[model samples]
Target: EAAVTQSPRNKVAVTGGKVTLSCNQTNNHNNMYWYRQDTGHGLRLIHYSYGAGSTEKGDIPDGYKASRPSQENFSLILELATPSQTSVYFCASGGLDRGTGGAQDTQYFGPGTRLLVL
Candidate 1:
């Protein structure tokens, strides 16, 4: 089973502070992703890694950076936290098999990490 978990399910940060969010997966999946979900908007990808030692910036990589030092762990770093960055972040893992035709690679998501900045 592919299982992903995130730390600090809730957080409160001051402006310009640093915040680090961690994620761990037991499924050993090749792809891991970090995303933020906000009301009236779809989940937006922040960062992703194909495997250990490889991290790539996603669509909304600004104000955030990512690290994947090992196969089981990935972290998201906010160097200068801002109230605009407040949102619920989710960690996810994608499996290789899509059941048929590889048309759908389902991404299993973690509960989420809600962050508030003030």
Candidate 2:
């Protein structure tokens, strides 16, 4: 099973400040993703990584940056936080399924991080 955890479950940041959200996974999955949940937009993908040392821009990657330093760690960085970015962020990990030997559509997600930018 995939086990993902996120740090700073709740955060309050100032406008134009910097915020870093961290995620760690123990499933050894090759794919990791960062997403933000909003009321109207639902869950929007901000960034994703295929593996360590590789990062990719997602559907909504304008102001967000992602990093995957190791197989178990992935981080989301907001260099200049804004009030519009305030939302609940989630980290997910998924990849090939050992049992099925096929790509797993099931993604294990972290509890979520609530960020309030003011």
Off by over 4 Å in 1: 98-104
Please estimate how well model 1 matches the true structure, expressed as its whole-model Cα lDDT: 0.90
Model 1 lDDT tens row, 1-118 = 4689999999999999999999999877788899999999889999999899999999999999999999989999999999999999999987675443342356878889999999
Off by over 4 Å in 2: 100-102
Candidate 2 residues 21-105, lDDT tens each?
9999998999999999999898999999999999999999998999999999999999999999999999999988777666766
Candidate 1 C-alpha error for residue 53, in Å: 0.7
Model 1: lDDT of residue 93: 82
Per-candidate Cα lDDT values, in order, are: 0.90, 0.94
| Each candidate's clash count | 0, 0
